[model samples]
Target: MKLYRHALSGHSHRAHLFLSLIGQPFELVDVDLAARAHKQPEFLKLNPFGQVPVLVDGDTVITDSNAILVYLSKKHGKTDWLPETPREAANVQRWLSVAAGDIAFGPAAARLVTVFAAPIDAEAAIARAHVVLKRMDDTLADSAWIAGSQPTIADVALYSYTARAPEGFVDLQDYAHVRAWLARIEALPGFVEFQRTPVGLTA
Candidate 1:
C-alpha cells in the first residue's frame, strides 16, 4: 500500500491516522504540495481532483480522504473501526457527513487561511466552527464517542480538524467536552498525531 499525502493537510491526516491505528504497513509517498506536485499530470491520474492523500493498494486506487477511511475501515479493519449493525453504521455516516460539510467549511477552511494564507472568510469559518464545536460538545456530553461508546471511523474523521481548531483562531476554551474527547483519542493505542503547525493565535 502507498499513501500519497501532504503533511499539513488534515484530510491526509485522517487516512494516515486510521492506517496507523489499524497497524497497517504501508509506505508514505510525500506529495510536494509546495511545488504544486499534486496538480501535475502524474499525480492527477491517481486523483483527478488533484488532491493529496490518494491511496494505492495493488490494483485498487482510492481517492478522497473520507472514502479512503471507509475503505480501510471496512476492508482491513473488518468490523472493528467500522460497525456491523445498520444503526451504528448510520451513526458513523452522520459524523462523516459533518466531517465533510461543517468541519470542512468551518475549522478546516479557517485553518487554511491562517496556516497557508489562503484567501477566505476567516470570520465566517470561525463562526461556523463555533456552531459545530458546540453541537459536538453537547452531543458528547452524553456519548463517549461521536458515533457511540467505541471509537469508529466517525471519531477518526472528525478528530483532526476539531483538535486543531484552535490553530485557526477558533478558540476551544469553552468546548471542554470537545477538548476531553480529543484527549481520549490521543490516549488511544496506535494513535498517530497530525503534524502541528504554529499559526494564527498560537503564533
Candidate 2:
C-alpha cells in the first residue's frame, strides 16, 4: 500500500495513523504541497480533487480521509474499528460526519490559516472550534470513545485535529475529557504522533 500525503495535513495524519494502528505495511509517499505537487497531472490522475492523503492498495485507490478509514476497516475485517451492527454503524457515521463538517471548518480551518497561510476567518474558525470541542467533551463524559466504549475509526477521524487544536489557537485546557481522551489514544499500541508545527498562539 502507498499513502500520498503532506506532513502538516491532519487529514493525511488520520489515514497514516490508522494504517499504523492496524499493523499494515505501507510506504509513505510525501506530496510536496509547497511545490503544488498534489495539483500536478500525475497526482491529479489519482484524485481529481487534487488532495493529499490518497491511499493506493493494489488496484484500489481511495480518496478522502474518512473514506480511507472505512475502506481499510472493512477490507481488513477490523469490525472493532468499524462495527457492522446497524446502530453501531450509524453511531460511527455520525462522528465521521462531524469530523468532516464541524471539525473541518472549526479547528482544522483555523490551523490552515496559521500553518499554511490559508485565507479563512481565523476568529470564526476558533469560535467554531470551541463549540465542537465542547460537544466532544460532553459526549465523552458518558462514553469512553466517541462512537462507543471502544476506540473506532470515529476516534481516529477526530484525533489529529483535536489533539493539535492548540496550534490553531483553539485552547484545549477547558475540555478536560477531550484532553484525557487524547491521552488515552496516545497510550494505545501502534499509535503514531502527528507532526506538530508551532503556529498561531503557540507561535
Candidate 3:
C-alpha cells in the first residue's frame, strides 16, 4: 500500500495512525503542498478533489480521511476497531460523523488558521471546539472509549485534531474526561501520534 499525504495534516495523520495500528505495511509518499503538487494533474488522478491522505491498496484507491479510516478498519483491522453488532457498528458510525462534522469544523479548522494561515474564523472554530469537547467529555464520563467499550476507528478518527486542539489556541484544559480519553488513546498498542506544529498557543 502507498499513502500520499502531508506531514502536518491532521487528516493525513489519522489515516497513518490507523494503518500503523492495524500493522499494515505501507509506503509513505509525501505530497509537496507548498509546490501545489496536490492540484497538479498527476496528483488529481488519485483524488479528484486534490486532497492529501489518499490511500492506494493494490487496485483499490480510497480518499477522504474518515473514509480511509473506515476502509482500513474493515479490511486490515481485526474485529476490535470496528464492531460487528448492529448497535455497536452504528454507535461507531455516529462518532465517525462527529469526526467528519464537528471535529473537522472545530479544532481542525481552528488549527488551519494558525498552522496553515488559512482564512477561517478562528474564534468561531474555537467556540465549536469547546462545545464538542464538552459533549465528548460528558460522553466519556462513564465510558473509556468514544463509541463504546473498546477503542474503534471512531477514536482514531477524532484523535489527531483533538490531541492538537491546543495548537489552534483552543485549550483542552477544562475538559478533563476528553483529556483522559486522549491519554487512553495514546497508550494503545502501535499508536502513532500527529506531529505537532508550533503555532497559536503552542507557539
Candidate 4:
C-alpha cells in the first residue's frame, strides 16, 4: 500500500496514526503541497479532489481521510474497533461525522488560519469552534469514547487536529472532557506522536 500525504496535514496524520497502530506495512510517498504538487494533473488522477492522504492499495485508490479509516478499520482492525451492531455502527458514524464535519470546519479551519496566516474571519472561526467544542464536551460528559466505552475509528478520526487545537488558537482549557479524552487517546497502545512542521505552511 502507498499513502500519498503531506507532512503538515492533520487529515493525513489520522491515516498515518491508524496505520502505525495496526502495524500495517506500507510505503509513504510525500506529496509536496508546498509546490502545489497535489493540484497538478498527475496527482489529480489519484484523487480528483486534489487532496493529500490518498491511499492506494494495489489497484484500489481511496480518498477522504474518514473513508480511508472505515476501509482500514474494517479490513485490519479488531472487531472492537469497527463493531458489528447497527446502533454501535451508528454511534461510530455519528462521531465520524462530527470529526469530518463540525471539527473540520471549526477547530481545524481555525488552526489553518493561524498556521498559514490566511485572511480568516477570526471572530467567526471562534464562534464556530465554541459551538463544536461545547457539543463535544457535552457528548463526552457521560461516555468514555465517542462511540461507547471502547475506542473506535471515530476517535482516531478526530484525535489529531482536535488535540492540537490550541496551535490553531482554539484553546482546550474550557473543554475539560475533551482534554481528558485527548489524554485517553494518547495513552492507547501503539499511539504515535503527531509530526509537527515549521509554522506558516498553507493547508
RMSD (CA, Å), each prediction: 0.8, 0.6, 0.9, 2.6
Candidate 3 per-residue lDDT, tens place, 74-104, comes to 7865678889899999999999999999999
- Ordering by lDDT: 2, 3, 1, 4
Query: Highest lDDT: which candidate?
Result: 2
Q: Stretches of candidate 2 above 4 Å error?
A: none
TM-score of model 1 (CA atoms): 0.98
Candidate 4 residues 1-203, lDDT tens each? 99999877899999988888788888989998879999999999999999989999989999999999989887775668788799999988998998888888887887778776667776677678889888888988999887888888888998998877776777788999989999999898888777753442222
Per-model TM-score versus the true fold: 0.98, 0.99, 0.98, 0.93
Of the two candidates 2 and 3, the one with more favorable lDDT, higher being better, is 2
The clash tally of candidate 3 reads: 0
Rate residue 180 of model 2 by lDDT: 93
At residue 39, candidate 1 shows an lDDT of 93
lDDT of 3: 0.93
Off by over 4 Å in 3: none
Query: Cα lDDT of model 1 overall?
Result: 0.92
> How far out, in Å, is residue 54 in model 4?
0.4
Global lDDT of each model?
0.92, 0.96, 0.93, 0.85
- lDDT-superior candidate, 1 or 4: 1
Name the lDDT value of residue 3 in candidate 3. Answer: 97
**Candidate 2 C-alpha lDDT tens digits along 1-203:** 99999999999999999999999999999999999999999999999999989999999999999999999999999999999999999999999999999999999999999998999999999999999999999999998899998999999999999998989999999999999999999999999999989887787
CA displacement after TM-score superposition, residue 66 of candidate 4 (Å): 0.3
